[model samples]
Target: KEFLQWYIKEQGEEEENSEANVKNIKEAGDDLSAVDEKMGTRGG
Candidate 1:
C-alpha cells in the first residue's frame, strides 16, 4: 500500500512536469529549435 501511494505520487509529479514543459514549448514561439537545443543540453 505504501509503495503504491509513492508510485502514484511520482507519476503525478512527472505528469505535471511534462505539462509545464509543453506549455513552455508552446509559449516559445518562433524559436522552438533554440529552446529544444537548450533543453537537450540541459537534459544531457
Candidate 2:
C-alpha cells in the first residue's frame, strides 16, 4: 500500500514536469519563428 501511494505521487509529479516541458518547447518555437522573420526582412 505504501508503494502504491508513492508510485501515484511520483506519477503526478512526472506529469507536471512533462506539461511544463511541452510549454517551454512551444514558447521556444514561437521565439525562433519571430527571429526567422526578422532575419528574412533583413536579407531582402
Candidate 3:
C-alpha cells in the first residue's frame, strides 16, 4: 500500500513535468530548434 501510494504520487509529478515541458516547447514556436538543443544537451 505504501509503495502504491508513492508510485501514484511519482507518476503524477512526472505527468506534470511532461505537460510543462510540452507547454514550453509549444511556446518556443519559431525557436523550437533551441529548445531541442537544450533538451538534448540536458539529456531530457
Models ranked on TM-score: 2, 3, 1
| Whole-model Cα lDDT of every candidate shown, in order | 0.76, 0.83, 0.76
RMSD of each: 9.5, 10.0, 9.5
TM-score between model 3 and native: 0.36
Please provide, for model 2 over 1-44, each residue's C-alpha lDDT reduced to its tens digit, 9 standing for 90 to 100.
99967765776589987677668778999999999999999997
- How many pairs of residues in model 2 come into backbone collision? 0
In terms of lDDT, which candidate is stronger, 2 or 3? 2
* TM agreement with the true structure for every prediction: 0.36, 0.66, 0.36
Which tens-of-lDDT digit does each residue in 1-44 have in candidate 3? 99967766776689887677667767787488787889899996
Worst 10 residues of 3 by lDDT: 21-30
The lDDT ranking, best first, is 2, 1, 3
Give the true-structure RMSD of model 3. Answer: 9.5
Candidate 1 Cα outliers beyond 4 Å, as residue runs: 1-13, 30-44
**CA displacement after TM-score superposition, residue 9 of candidate 2 (Å):** 18
Question: What is the TM-score of candidate 2?
Answer: 0.66
